[model samples]
Target: MKSFRLFLIASLIFITNNFLFSQEEDVVEDSTETLEVYLIDNYLQGENEKILVLSWMTNLPTKSKVKIEEIGTFNVSDTLTDFHQTKIDLSNVRFTKNEYMFKIISELEDGSSVESEEYSFLVPFEEKDTSSTKSTTTSQQVKTSSSYYIYNFALGITLWLLPSPALAFENNKTKFAILKDLPLVSIGSFSAYKTFPYVYFYAGYVHIPEGFVKNSFRLGTKYLYELPEIKHFVSLGLGGFTNFKGSNGINGEIGFSFLKVLKTFEMTASYSYNYLPSSKNKFHLFSIGLFTSSFSINLNY
Candidate 1:
């Protein structure tokens, strides 16, 4: 009876070992299986404000990212999902009329990744006026042909506010800046403009102080004309200033704009004459600054 018991115990141990070995083999096989993620459909869409939308469907749920040719990879989905949609903000994109190659990569749960076939599309033509014409190219027209207005806002850092005791570009006893803590003077300005094909109508406000002049507030309007193809502009403006001291004046300005640096940043210089007829005092102001309109939006008619 003891011998029989020993035989039964040995048989049980062998059976248990075989069972464990089979489970290990099954797990290894499952892990080594091929990843079968694939795209069922994929397409790109265009929107206003230079936005590009990409949408795709995968056969299996998986995390995915899109890889654009010039741009880097952008995440489309973090969690497992078969459907993916992502918007690419290309307002800052510098290249125009260039083709971009892109692909989607999906990562599966089994530590393997699959990539969809490559696709290509061209950027809208730079010279093509989306506001006035239709595009037959791959890029879609964001606005209708009837749309004739483009709205923009600009904020500038005044490098020098030279309230010269005389004319344009003349040096003064006191100069002000938005960045520096110069004595008795600091300056800031913001403006909004609406553009037609070649002209701009603008309104702006300026902040002054007693140190510069008693008025402390300057409001204005400008009529600007673009110099064809050269990326330069000139403007004439008329406005007024008033403050608590009951001191007030009417101001007029002549301004020039340099080319838009990198299609975003702009440099401007202007000269203004402030005449306080009541006080019989006149001030000449010249300013140079860098301006940006990264947040500017174009309004369509």
Candidate 2:
């Protein structure tokens, strides 16, 4: 009986030690070898210049954060419930003109983390000489091209004739317009060979009598399409304007435009229909404007 008890006690001790060691292994952390991280470039949205966000993927689910070398810390990533792919916001970081280096650090609930290698990027047109007008112009052009490639522009005027008592077309409404596109026309000597989807802008006037129309000036965006192998183009737009008495004139304007870019300029025409309850009026405009090398139009953003 004594010998049997000794054997049992030894067996219990061995089992206990093995169990404790196995638990320690489970609690132990894994290295960042499974983490893959990189940076995305910034783009200008409206008047704001957006910062580059960090994107990463992991083989395991983990919490992530990004730290810039000198700028500051960013928000903790959305709880990475899944490890497939994620984008972390860099907007909170205050960035200045210069080169910057940043990294991604991923953590776990057990207080362990894996950090990424340093990544670097440049913020454009920052900290440059303010005296050189040429340098300033170049920088501004670069900024504009990065945001808008203005390849085509058009200016047109319209005459709207309303029949009156004596004159055949007595009340004449004279209006003017300009249409433009972000140019993806040519990259050096090579002409773009694809149908282009683009955005255009419109600014115009509708000359109705002061009592008939208030705030005839109009500005809006249009989606433009220019077909490859042909200079013809089409577009649609949704816009808002002041009414004859100065409220909301064109609440939802469905505009249709077709224009042909020529050797020197372009010829264009468009129709706008606004269907409001109990209202039966439409807008027709004809313009000679500039043309583009591609095709596109998107009225809703």
Candidate 3:
């Protein structure tokens, strides 16, 4: 009887140990399965809002808990399963000129935890506005400040100093001869403000140089409407260019410009047709060319 009792006790102990081992193994397997999460936001811009999403998968029958934080601040915390969507308000988020970054975290029912790699995106900002504005009053005031006058003056001077069509025609004998007999040189300056998508205005001086000495001028204003693609611009201006020496007047033109931006360069092709007054010689001036062999660099603020 003693031996039988001892054998029975040994059998019970063996069965109990096996059951405990099996339970622990099941728990380990459950913990190994974790949830996955990610963020989605591209082309974020100023005063615009965006949404961030979190997603996961689980085989367990129990509900799982998911939590999210941004830069150590709790943005979202909830019990979730299968899928979850969250909307983040980015209206006040201050993004750097070119890039933005965010972080996310997730947890599963079996006490398993997982983290996502930092996600980043690139966005381009309008550099000219930030560099040109610095005041609390009207935009016109900011634009007309003394600093702006100095900046534009310096820019114009620099252009005159550099090698341009004007300079090239004046110095080279071959170019001078070609331009001297041409009898017309058109000059224009334009300023555009892109405050919204698919809309902008251009304002500046449009002049035509006429006469043997190239001392004549034409003053005019042009209204331009750009297409949605931003690759094409059409303009109409009403003005007159005078050949003071000859007492002749040349009517203004309706012009169009097409532009293509490459990785390191920009190309522009333009055309204009002039309508002469009945008193002057009725003729047309047409031009087509490309701005190439030049480098384009973008600076951000």
Cα lDDT tens digits for candidate 3, 1-301: 9999999999999999999999999999986744444333333333235333333333332233323223233435466443333454555544435555654555556555555566664544334456567533211111357988788667644433332122112122222111111102222222122211221222122223441234334544444455547655565655555446654454454656565533311222333333335443333333332222111121111
Poorest lDDT segment (10 consecutive residues) of candidate 1: 179-188
Q: Write the per-residue lDDT of candidate 2 for residues 193-286, one digit (tens) a residue.
A: 2233466554544443332332355556666665544655566676655544534456333333255334433444445543223333334334
After superposition, which runs of candidate 1 have C-alpha atoms over 4 Å from their true positions? 1-43, 46-215, 292-300
Better of 2 and 3 by lDDT: 2
Report the Cα lDDT for residue 92, model 2: 52
- Best-fitting candidate, measured by lDDT? 1
TM-score list, all predictions: 0.36, 0.32, 0.29
Residue pairs whose backbone atoms clash in candidate 1: none
What is candidate 3's CA lDDT for residue 33? 48
Look at candidate 3 and tell me the lDDT of residue 15.
100
Off by over 4 Å in 2: 1-50, 82-97, 109-111, 136-301
lDDT score of model 3? 0.40
Colliding residue pairs in candidate 3: none
Cα-based lDDT for every prediction: 0.57, 0.46, 0.40
lDDT of 1 by residue, 63-140 (tens): 888888777888887887666677777767776545778888889876478887787756664555578886455455
For TM-score, the strongest prediction is 1
